[model samples]
Target: MPALEITDLTRLYRRKGGEDFEALAGVDLTVPEGEVHGLLGPNGAGKTTLCKIISTVLLPTSGTVRVLGHDVVTDTHAVKLALGVVFGGEKGLYERLTARQNLDFWAGAYGLSRRRRRARVGELLERVGLDGRADERAGSFSRGMKQRLHLARGLVSDPGVLILDEPTVGMDPVAARDFRALVHELRDGGTTILLTTHDMAEAAALSDRVSLIDRGRLELTESPGTIGDLVSAYERVDARGVPDHVRDRIAALDGVVSVREDQGSLVRVETEQPDATLAVLRTLVDSGVRDVARSRPDLEEVYLHLVGRRGMGVDR
Candidate 1:
């Protein structure tokens, strides 16, 4: 069985205006064991709603979700026992309590034995690099430190699956890198993870596969690189004072597929081969376009093309 399975899941909310809003519309997804699957979407795309449903924090209006072969609704206890969730923002950690105290309180909530709780708390603190500041109050910790603590608290029960929603939000470069490494360690240790983040680069770097959600539905599911799989590669060329005739000529090149003018004196070029870069530059330069620069498309570009151009809600 898949570590996480969701089929035709839908959640609806009634507005004060007496209209129904669909938060999730017939979404289906599966995450295999020991894999990192990324969910990417704009706000209100239903990523967090799905995660909440799987974690048993919200009831689905319709459809089914199962974790580790247990139904999330009917077998809520079993599913809860198997999941570790870290949602974005502060989730009511006692600000005045030391990190150790907060962790101890959560560990006790999980019903850990006194002896095991002590060892587990100590191990988690060290794992998240908080052992050095174990006695410090949570309110005094940095954003990155609190994020690490949140992750540790999720793992306190040693659950089989981890769900992280925007886990690296507000983290510094160094902290984000370290946290990504920790995620890899957990996956290597056979922990299945369902991750959602607005960080396109992070999603591309860590996820073996990714699902693009849009307007409460699954739009595409494939390897992260293949999300914009329409072309093998692409380039963005920005030129100043270039004539329309010259742009047309460049678009008619052998490897070029489509050329679209973008805002602020930019043109995007989709190509069939990476070697098309020099050819494109030569064409543009020969056409009296001196101010031209070319670069390959990254995940951000692809994501923009997918969700942005489609008119989805862009939070960033």
Candidate 2:
């Protein structure tokens, strides 16, 4: 059975201007058990809306959602019980409470017994590396520490499925690395994970398969390595002092869709085929565009191609 399933999910809301806007438009997906699936999209792509719907924070206007065979609308409590959620951004932690106290409070709210609560709190605090700082007040901790505390809260339930939305959104590079390692460890221990992230490297590194969504529609779902192989990407070609005429000539070549001039007369071209694209660079050398080099496709390029390039700067 799938860990989570969504069939034709659609949500609409009335804007203040008296217009109805669709937040999630017939969104559909199925994440297999124990696999790490990624939800990726630009701004207003309904990634968060879908998360909210599944998390029971928001209701869907239509369609069916089943998390571990429990409907989000009908068996809300059962749905919550089956999953652990780590939403990106600041959590609703009590600022004045120590990490230990906060965990104890949430564990009690989650109905963990006094004995289990204490033991689980200790286990998670250590898992997130906050055991040493468990006694310190939450407000005094850094943003990364706070995120770790929230992660502990999410796992205190010992859920079967984990939903991570931008799980490492605000941490330093080191902290983000640690958190990702922890995610892998959990998945190895048999927890199915569905992750939403804007970071390309994180998605590429951790996800078994990535579902790229845009404007509430799934663009394509593919393995990260396969996504790398099948997309037309803007490859940064090295050329300095290349005149507009030369740039235009390269753009006109087959498999070269567009050419852009960046700083210091460096030209970047969107290539349909990476191999054919690089071949065009040899032509550039023949035509006098200097120093053509290839760069790996970044998440920005992939996002721009999947999501519309116009006015899509803030979906996070």
Candidate 3:
């Protein structure tokens, strides 16, 4: 069975004196066991709504969701048992509780006995690199340290499916690196992960395949490499000192997607074929424009192309 199976998922919220807002629109997604699936989109794009429904915190307005072959609606207990959810930031932790105490509390909630809770808590602390500071109060820990503890709390039940909602949001470079390594370790141990993030680089680095969602709709789902290749067909050329006539000529070239002038005499050309790119370069060079550079768009650029630019933050 797939680790997560979502079919025709939809959620609607009624607003006073206004039309109901659709948070998710007939979405369908399936994640096989042990796969790391990245969900990417800007704020107010329904990423959190999807996560909340899958975690059973909110009932979907419509649709069926299954975790480990158990329906989220019909088999809530089984779904909860198989799933671990970690939302980013410090809101979830108890300020006065020590790291060990916090994890123990969650482990107990998962129904682990006293002896097993003790062992599981210790193992989790070590796994998240917090064994050395297990006794420290959560409030005293750094942002990175607290995020690690959050991850440990999520694993208290040894869940088969982990939903990490922007898991590395406030982490520093080193801490983020450590957290990603831990994710890889868990995947190696056969844990399925659904990672939601606004960070394009993070999604590209960690996901086996990524699904892009926007305004409650899925744009596409593809491997990072495959997505890169799709965008690779379009290349960019930047040149300085191009006259208007030459710029217009380049714009009329076959496969040229767009040609826009930047500041002053600098011009940017976007092309969808190698021949177009070469033609653009030849036109620039022949026009005596020596300050020219050609490059391919990166993941972030591709994301903007597909999803459009929106201010980054948590989803509504």
Off by over 4 Å in 1: 90-92, 225-232, 254-278, 296-300, 304-308, 312-316
- Per-residue C-alpha lDDT of model 1 across residues 1-316, encoded as one tens digit per residue: 9999999999998788877888899999988989899998777778898999999999999999999999999999899889998998765578899999999998998889889999999999998889999999999988888888998999999989999999998788888888999999998999999999877668778898989887888988889788544434556666676788887887888777568777867776666566676787888888878888676665455555565555434432
- Against the true structure, candidate 3 reaches a TM-score of 0.85
By TM-score, the candidates rank as 2, 1, 3
| Clash list (residue pairs), candidate 3 | none
**Candidate that scores best on lDDT:** 3
How high is the lDDT of residue 190 in model 2? 84
Q: What TM-score, computed on C-alpha atoms, does each candidate reach?
A: 0.88, 0.90, 0.85
Q: lDDT tens string, model 3, 1-316?
A: 8999999999999889988999999999999999999998777788889999999999999999999999999999999999999987778998799999999999998999999999999999998899999999999999888999999999999999999998998888988998999999999999999999977678878999999988898889999787656677778999988888999999999999888887977788988787899999999999998999999865555555677655344345
Cα-based RMSD of candidate 3: 3.2
lDDT (Cα atoms) of all candidates against the true structure: 0.84, 0.83, 0.89
Per model, state how many residue pairs clash. 0, 2, 0
Clashing pairs in 1: none
